[model samples]
Target: MSVFSARTGLAAALAVAALASGGCTQLRSHQGYVVDTDLVNSVQPGVDNRQSVLATLGKPTLAGQFDQGDWYYLARDSRNLAFRNPRPNAQITLQISFDQKGTVTAIRRGGLDQVASIKPYGKKTPTLGRERGFFQDLFGNIGTVGAAGAGGGAGNGSNTGGGGRDRP
Candidate 1:
């Protein structure tokens, strides 16, 4: 065979081999799903048991901590190329808690799709004294005598308004 034809055949063989074996490529099926939301909502505290919950929902993505009897079903969608920053572009975490009697007690859903981030509420208090911008400190604050004296006149105020470029 000509070298050109032989090289073409070799390329084809390598492509086939790559496809047959799951080589250096992540083949995506373009699909993902969560268990039925309706079915999950149907659970009640008094009626549900640990065994029945497990049977209905299958293995949880996350188990409880300190034997809190909680189970989590997490589903996340994020777009990140290999070796790229992978922040929580999108995420969904469903957590179910059971009483010691193994009955459902609470269910919580958290995801990035909402405006509120998944921050623990009581752990940190919001700081009201964030740093102010230079312009805001100049304009919004008029009662301060030290500030007014510093920029008393237009000559010393350092003309912070829009520079009139189009006007003569």
Candidate 2:
């Protein structure tokens, strides 16, 4: 090849290499509260109350549903490459409990060891009770309804002329 053509070919190859490398790069993301170890460690039970924790760590990711005494701070770092599903690289679950008096009673921390993966068995969820087809479900109650003994409130078809009741 000529010198100018060789240079042009080398530049095109470099551009393609850069684009391919960019596609393989891992995409990193963060969700929920961003954790600071120093601030978290600074919180001491019996000393820090709800107000101080809120001021230090800001608002929690979630609070107790039934009772407002428990606070939960969740932080997760995830990464994925190309079309792959994102997987957790790191996770932090911080739970701070408070007594009825709103004083910090306990501080608990958890990591990825607490993560659980649940894969469903099939396309349709399994449920209890009999499985009926579409036609059966539509016409299953046809004969059962409006029948005399089926609590339809219609008297028997007797011809006693006493309104279907036996004479005394």
- Each candidate's number of clashing pairs is 0, 0
Best by TM-score: 2
lDDT of each: 0.70, 0.90
Off by over 4 Å in 2: 127-168
> What overall lDDT, based on C-alpha atoms, would model 2 receive against the true structure?
0.90
lDDT of 1 by residue, 1-168 (tens): 699999999999999997766444433221133667777877776788778878887788878786765988877665544445344455667788888878888888887765254646696665688777789877965755455456555655456566844433
Q: For model 2, name the residue pairs that clash.
A: none
